[model samples]
Target: MELQQLRYVVAVAETSNFTRAAERCQVVQSALSHQIASLERELGARLFERTSRRVWLTPAGEAFLPAARECLEAADRARAEVAAASGEVRGRLAVGAIPTVAAVDLPVVLKEFRRRHPRVHITLTSAGSDDLTEQVRKGGVDVAFLGLPTRVEPRAVQSRRLARGELVAVVSPDHHLTDAEMDLRSLQGEPFVDFRAGHAGRAQSDEAFAAAGVRRDVAFEVSSADFMADLVRQGLGVGMLPAAYAPRFHDLRIIRLRDAPERVEYLVWGAHPSPAATAFLELVDHGTGQARDRPDPDGPAG
Candidate 1:
């Protein structure tokens, strides 16, 4: 019924322990229980099922939890917007990225973001490019860095291209594909260690081979850049990585793919972005200078 009561319910639901929930809410167990009871009485629904050993949400509680969280988020955003108007940015910034985001050094950029907006809480998630794009579109992520093949674009969300580059082949020093430069056909019939079939990273290679009229085996479907490199180093299969990114594995030989697939890095955000998200876009685009016109909810997301 009230915000505090909702908070108590949410805390309890998340921790699934009355004592832990009270501790999280900075309230005593009795007070937290009383507030939840009061809220339950008001709504005429039992919000939780309490056994001595365990606590879990009731059906009513399950139904109520999402709206309660949304209310809290809305309130937080309202406060953050007020602070932003007064020249202070305070809100949560959820960032999503694929494993190989090479347009900028992420640690360096995140460190800078932290320094500039100390009050904004930040969280980062790593997933496939397509998954990151969907999270951005759904507002689960505030901003994202994505990589997709040249023929594709992150649709239904606002996106800006950061960089476009080709993927180079990496072979263990002992492999017999000795040419310094080769097309997709040169690597034909060779085993490849690539991203999972549905992942955007894998799609980049898949599209290339399909376009070149070649069918190759993705012998090892991995998700990590280091894992990809490791497999290639052991002569298990050939590895493909961005041209700029492959140099980090110094021991491997880099073969320029004359007809390599091109991947374009994109920076994406929701159409209606938070104040903290707007501030971040400004920082990334304009340096530490004054805030620029971006993350405008009224503006196009792309």
Candidate 2:
């Protein structure tokens, strides 16, 4: 039977009189009687025994009353839950970010977002850019902080650049090259600690080196920026890292290369985002100077 049949049965069971039940249900008495007859026929049981002066429930009606009430309650709850999910701003948000962006930028933004929308539960994951992109594409994440060169399927995802951060040289303060800004050419033949292959930053570094007609003396290949920084601190080699990531360590000198191309971080999502995700993108775009009509490609100047 349809949900309306269940509802009508419950209303009739509550009132025990077809006239009163029809009035309560806002339907004609004949229509209510016809629907109730259809419901009982569908169930193969008479729900009510009717005489000229009295209306009374049969054993079948008594048994069906509680089940009908339960079905109506469940339908109501389902509607309420769906409405809450669509209209309320409270829910879980699964967000993914590249390791560097998660370490350097997400903490502050997430703090503010939590303060503003306290009811939203957030789950954050940090992985490589390629991995994060795959997570977003697979519907595993609601939103992601992904680096450029992501292979986003057309019409399935959209991206907004959030900030532009450049690769800078990181070296111990005592290193010979630590005192001055170095060009990509200057890094030629210098001992370097590089990221593992398939990393966006590593690819960018390789491109910069190729453009500058230089080769990196890669002393070690590591996956994490913090580890690379530690290697540089030990004077193992100089390394190239995002500018925002360089400030996390002490006793390390950060030098901007004169000719290094900038790397940009983007907020990526399925074509449409939830309200909470959209709000987050707005805050990031504003805070990072990416919201302006003519946003500077390098972000706001320091």
Best by lDDT: 1
Quantify all predictions' global Cα lDDT against the true fold: 0.86, 0.73
**Residue by residue across 108-210, what tens digits does model 1's lDDT show?**
7788889988999999999998898888877789999888887788988888776677889999999998999989998889999999988899888888899
lDDT of 1 at 233: 95
- What RMSD does model 1 have? 4.5
TM-score of every prediction relative to native: 0.91, 0.63
Clashing residue pairs for model 1: 158-301, 158-302, 159-302
lDDT of 2 by residue, 13-118 (tens): 7787889989999999999899989988889999999887678889999999888876775575455456457765555567887766622357777887788767
Worst 10-residue lDDT window for candidate 2 reads 288-297
Backbone clashes, candidate 1: 3
What lDDT score is found at residue 302 in candidate 2? 12
Measured with C-alpha atoms, the lDDT of residue 278 in candidate 1 is 89
Candidate 2 residue runs with Cα over 4 Å from true position: 1-87, 102-104, 149-156, 286-295, 298-302
Name model 1 segments beyond 4 Å from true: 287-301
